[model samples]
Target: MTTLSPARALPSAAEVALARESSRTLSAYLQTRAETQQIEIVDDQGAAHPVRVPVSALRLLVDLLTEIGAGNAVSIIPIHAELTTQDAADVLNVSRPFLVQLLERGEMPFHKIGTHRRVRYQDVIAYKERIDVERNKVLDALAEQAQELKMGYE
Candidate 1:
């Protein structure tokens, strides 16, 4: 069980601009049907290193860059990583007490390690997806009701 660190600060304005440009270039290149791509890295000594990377990894990089470009902070957690209750709550954008209640109610799976509760990253994500689907369903139902009532919500 690995613990994740707290998220870093938001990207600076210059970083956002650079990320936007880089993502645009990489995204355009990714439009090709290639399985892999070669990229060059220049060291401090001005030496160039050509490295081959998978398209999947490049796609993920592009996504990270896109988020940074939008001035948003991002963190990458492995699917199998374990998270503390607070960390899980942060991921779900909820209070720690609320997350604890959900855990106690068995809405999500968790385990205790020396009196501390730990939740799997995958489990937290699954719970979030489940609630998101339910919320969307209720929203759709409400929209339909509003339309039927001629409430001008259409």
Candidate 2:
């Protein structure tokens, strides 16, 4: 399989609008249809061709389009794919040094390819989710404490 380079920017306003419309169409079609069998694609010359698309691939496309529609830049990396430290850092929105620290501290699992450490995409995502959940729990506790103390306007 061929891997595409990462997109470096958020979608343009026009692209986002188009993506939103396409996402809505996909959503509506999926909602009404019992099963997705095949779809027709129109060429630039207005020629229609029927093609078979897997339901899983279609679902992924819909999700990607939805994210793009929300003005977010999306990356398609397989869950089992391995990533470099810098790539993992970028995905987690953390500094490379910090990611290294996490790896060193055994917070996330990694395997060394020679001298270089490689982490699985799934591992990074799991770590991010765990961090987010912990952060949310702390925030919730703080909010409760603040409410008990009657701090600020509820």
Candidate 3:
């Protein structure tokens, strides 16, 4: 039920280049194998240590690296994590007041603890997905209408 902290700042130019290279190399290695792989890690003291990593974790790391390589900030939230209203609003890219309105309207489920409200991470994600689908549908309908009216839409 722990909440994740805010996303880190975007990767710097050097970090982005390193992430892109590392992601490419790791992705290629992953494609060749499905089992746990041993990778060497060098410490600041120049001592090399071999570590065994699960394929699943490596895949997740690759995804994270890819996003960082693209200069995007990233944060990981567990599906079952509970979030504060501000955290949920940040995830939805909406204001906290607007999110409270949605909670009051039951657009997404939430529960109150004492006086503060808490929302499930999965519920917030599901709500966002539903909103995105509806937005796409509306945009598609508008495009179709424009085409029918020959309003310079093809």
Index of the highest-lDDT prediction: 1
lDDT of 1: 0.95
Off by over 4 Å in 2: 1-4, 32-35
Q: Write one digit per residue (lDDT tens) for candidate 1, span 60-151.
A: 99999999999999899999999999999999999999999999999999999999999999999999999999999999999999999999
Worst 10 residues of 1 by lDDT: 1-10
lDDT tens readout by residue for model 2, 131-154: 999999999999999989999938
TM-scores of the candidates in the order shown:
0.92, 0.88, 0.95
Ten residues in sequence with the least summed lDDT for candidate 2: 28-37
- The superposed Cα distance between candidate 1 and the true structure at residue 3, in angstroms, equals 2.3
For model 3 the local lDDT of residue 10 reads 81
